[model samples]
Target: MAKIMALDYGLKRVGIAATDDLQIIASAIGTQPTAHIWEFLKTYLAQNQIEAVVLGDPKNLDGSATDATAPTEAFANEFRKRYPEIELHRMNEVFTSRIARQTMVSGGMKKKQRQQKGMVDQISATIILQDFLSRRSNGLF
Candidate 1:
């Protein structure tokens, strides 16, 4: 099966994650500067067979779109225009960053490592991918 990739997009950087070939596990790939996201995707897609792309959809506590929504949607539109063949999805990303932080602490990561924003972003991407996988498995995607 082709792998599914996820992105936790930020203004400064984008976190990347991908499922295994079997699509059974979601793991963090790395972070890329936002300015080079398209370039990074070109290289990544060239080397990997990706069937779909999942992007984090930031939302407020009351279920409304947050301030980050517009930029994310704009990015998604550009991504779709660039890669029309690949499927794109937006998964709700409420509290994924906090969850990632908690996960790091529980997983025994050192304070210094946990302080790295890139690490949090990567982990958040992983969380987004995992959520996508679960929803998919439950026929909710």
Candidate 2:
């Protein structure tokens, strides 16, 4: 089976993560500047056989879309337009940042590492991918 990629999009930087070829373990791919996202993704897609792309979708606590949602959805749309053959999925991104922080803490990350916002993005992408994998494993449409 082809691997999957997950993205945690920000205005300036984007966090990326990918699943193993077996689709069992998720790993942080790194963060990239918005200006280089397309090139980075093109190179990554060319190197790895990715079947789908998952993006973090921000929403309000009450399930309403947030202001960031607009740009995120736009990004997803543009990504679809650019990579028409790839499947794109948006996963609800609630508490992902918090979870990322907690994960860093639990992982005994250094202060400097924890202070880096890019690390949070990578962790967020991992969480997004994990959620997507779980949902797919359960056959949730």
Score every model by TM-score: 0.98, 0.96
Best by TM-score: 1
Which residue window of length 10 is worst by lDDT in model 2?
Answer: 132-141
- Estimate, for each residue in 1-141, the C-alpha lDDT of model 2 and write its tens digit: 999999999888899999999998888999999889999998989999988999999998899988888889899999999999889998999999999999999999998999998999999999999999999999983
Shift of residue 79 alpha carbon in model 1, Å: 0.7
lDDT of each: 0.96, 0.92
Best by lDDT: 1
Shift of residue 112 alpha carbon in model 1, Å: 0.3
**What is the Cα-based TM-score of model 1?**
0.98
**Residue 70 alpha-carbon offset, candidate 1, angstroms:** 0.8
Which window of 10 residues has the lowest lDDT sum in candidate 1? 59-68
